[model samples]
Target chain A: MDLIESYKEDLRLIRRFGTGFWIVLLLIGLILLPWFAREYWVYVVTLIFIYSIGIQGQNILIGYTGQISFGQAGFLAIGAFTYGHLSLLGSPILVNLFFSGLMAGIFGILVGFPSLRLKGPYLAIVTLGFGIAVYQVFVNSEILSGGRMGLTIQKLQPLFGLSQMTTYYYFNFILVFLFTLLSYNLISSFVGRAFIAIRDNDIAAEAMGVSLTRYKLLSFAISSFYTGVQGGLYALLMGYLEPNMFTFLETITIFVAVIIGGLASVEGSILGAAFVVMVPQVFSNTKAFIPVIYGVTILIILIFEPLGLSGRWMKIRLYLRMWPFR
Target chain B: MPLLEIKDISISFGGIMALSGISLQVQEEKIIAVIGPNGSGKTTLFNCLTGIYHPNEGEIHLNGENILRLSPDAIAELGIARTFQNLRLFMNMNVLDNLLVGRHLHFRKNPLLPMLRIRKEEILHRKIIEEIIDFLDLQAYRKARVADCPYGVQKRVELGRALALEPKLLLLDEPISGLTSEEKEEAAYRINEIRGRFQMTILLVEHDLRIASRLADSMVAFYYGQKIAQGTPEEVQRNPEVIRAYLGDD
Candidate 1:
């Protein structure tokens, strides 16, 4: 009985302290990373953070609610443009970020109307078309895209006591952390439960009093908000805005991150974003094989761990904890 | 006034009439069992009443308010809850989570609270879920995913979910057709208990005569999308049309 009680306590401890401990340790690692790593590596890590934020939004849509959007880059473009214009106008960085997300979220609500009546491949087509259309509109607009010559802010304000790169990196990190916490909260709440119910069996969800149109649009708006914020961060990091940045392939990369990370798992988005962002660096010398390597890695992940890296990580952790006994 | 009144409700699929001019009136706090053979329009009637299908003609009234044009969730919000014939529990979610979805209508819209880990409303609602779990004897299996649970457990979870709505009326679609004898008895007991405890009306669809006769306050029989007979259990069970539909003329 005493042994059983001790085992139970151990399980409780693991449940309570496990996530917080890892998060703190990871934060420490990230803070120390730039000090030891080169400038290029710091830039790559910043990109990873931005991508992770976008992928978290994708996870909410595709993973939690089982909705698909192939035009995520459309929202991202809207965010990036909003941020670029606001920053050029000498607005505070925080205000720029907030409005960037606000603009993208409004667009998300517009797109969400079609999603109410569409599903599967039909929805995917609409989103795909939407992404390309936004890209074309931005590319052709002289004021927005600077007539294909692109736009740039003369200077970006950095937080005091930090270098430009360091400030941006930390800013991205802070936003990622805040948004991850937000996603976790939403997932465990009534709104999140309703999304899963709609995903699993919509008729039952409706029968139980979940409004189909309301939640569908809500998920779209919320996910777009996250993507829009990430877009602002991306524009700030790049210091330049180009219509090409919001291409169809960009949206595909975000989708890949969500799938490879684990649909519906918050940590999966981070892992997937990191992998998509950094893996290209490893094959920088082998430009011809980049797509090949990317394809092969995704195929393997899908076959062996359909739930993505998060699922594999859980299995590994469980195995390590019960090692030799199992 | 009757708690629910279905008047001249008709529905068709590709010109094939599923329910043709069928009507029903359910009194407040009384159990009404709908018994019919397969393809006899029992589920179609429920679907029309719940807004899963729009009747080609006629009206549905809940407490004197016309609800035919309302969406399913809107109907549910106006104090209606239902279970499915095929056990439509969210297969990806655990039993507790499935039941939590049942409380969707009760939650105040606060999307940001859970992110901050606030639990004021969640804690309150969870207490209600706990009560439901105990009432359904789902304590042992609350953590189990519905996809992995046994059929009998899934059926109970579905019922528990509808109960969580705290609706004025409960629509149970074949609640005990697939259960073991013991499970059936348990379900029968719960049905009787629910009527007394909640003082809520029930529209039960059952193929089992024994369970229907034992539990229902009144019984209605249907044949080919039209009402054949309705009265006490004995009256319907002895009706020639219901007998011919079920047992066939020999």
Candidate 2:
């Protein structure tokens, strides 16, 4: 018991102080990443950050509200289109991005309102239809969206005078940090609790005076907004936008990032994003065998650890933490 | 008129009648217990009151407003709160969060205000949250996860959440059915405490006859899907139909 108590004390200390230290350490590493790594690795890190933003939104929707959305990518496209179109019209990058996200939020509210009314599989199908519809809209809207061929997106200039990769690297890094911190705070607040209440048991939550319809719609709106921001960022970073860019496959890719990382965990999103972005490149050398290996590995994870790689790692960590005393 | 009146409420599922022309009036600030055997439609009545299942026939009035047309959440907004027969506490949240969620309907502020860190909204939210935490003596578990808590504490947490709404009328469906005798005593104390301390009106649905007799001001007994007897606790206890239906024989 004494050993357990002592261990708990250490765990508390780690949670309280260790997190700050690690965050600082992570910032330093991220800052230095461009110094040692090539342009390709920098690209990979950017992808991770972008994917993590979507994963964070998914975490809120799935983890707290227990509402599964397969249409986050569609919202992302709306955001991307809003930003890309506005920037092409010579709007400032930040303004374009912000308004793009807001625009996505409007669509989210639109999609969320009806989707929330439906239950389970109905909700999924509706959102799935949304993704397909958006893809089609981008394809058929030739004059505005540039049809299937795509358009070159405007590269956002640095907020400062520096035009170097260093400045852009740091800017993207800040995006990741700000997004993570905001997501964390929102998920830990009263609104977050309401989301969890709805998720855990809606009937009980309603009795406690939780407005299920409003809050369920709110989750969809919020998640869609974040996913929208991610879409805007994707367009800016790629210096391009196209119908082909946002696809049905991208929705599955978002799922892979979140589920493989950890469904409800923020760190899992980051880890999953990094893994998803990096593994494809590393396996590029293997070529033929990579897809088979990837498929089998994903199948194993689904069968053995539906909670994802982070969940498995957590069990190991718990076991290690409980060693000796156990 | 009584504080809450349900008149001729009938709800049917396909061909089966869940509740048929059930009507009851609850006077203000009274401990009214609804007791019945299984499948007597006791929970179905609670569901109708809370707007879970809309009645095919009848009207419910709260404070002279027709609540039958109100959605479950709308009914809740009109100062009515409830607890499920099945322990339906937000099981994954902390004690404080559980109570905080209860104030969702009461805390009416623009969602954007909190995100913007609007000082006034934050202050009001914090004040409510603190008040609820203090009321429940849940300050200790404010940061603890709900999944780790025991069943009894979870029950109390659910009660705390309902109390957070500051409802004029509380509908507790089987608040003490699954509790131990010790828990039943505790539950009875809490119910009395709310009545005495908060001066809140309560309608309890319980299986424990002894608990009912001790806590209730009046008792309403149901057989099948209709109310067989309702009066002062002593009057209802002595009612022959209640005795035959519940007390077996004397």
Best by TM-score: 1
- Kindly list the per-residue Cα lDDT of model 1 for residues A1-326, writing each as its tens digit: 12323322422312546676986898899989878888888989989989888899989999999988998999999999999999889889889999999999999988888998999889999989888999999988888877656879554556777778887788888888888878887887898898999899888899889999999998999889889998888888888999998888788788888889998899899999998888778878887776676678789989989999999998988898789877
Candidate 2 accuracy as lDDT = 0.78
Q: After superposition, how far is residue A302 of candidate 2 from its true place, in Å?
A: 4.1
Lowest-sum lDDT 10-residue window in model 1 chain A = A1-10
**Interface RMSD of each candidate, angstroms, one decimal:** 4.0, 5.8
What are the per-candidate TM-scores when only chain A is compared?
0.92, 0.88
Can you write out model 1's per-residue Cα lDDT over B74-101, one digit (the tens) per residue? 9999999999999888998999899989
Clashes of each: 0, 0
| Candidate 1, residue B232: lDDT | 99
lDDT of each: 0.89, 0.78
On a 0 to 100 scale, what is the lDDT of residue A251 in model 2?
83
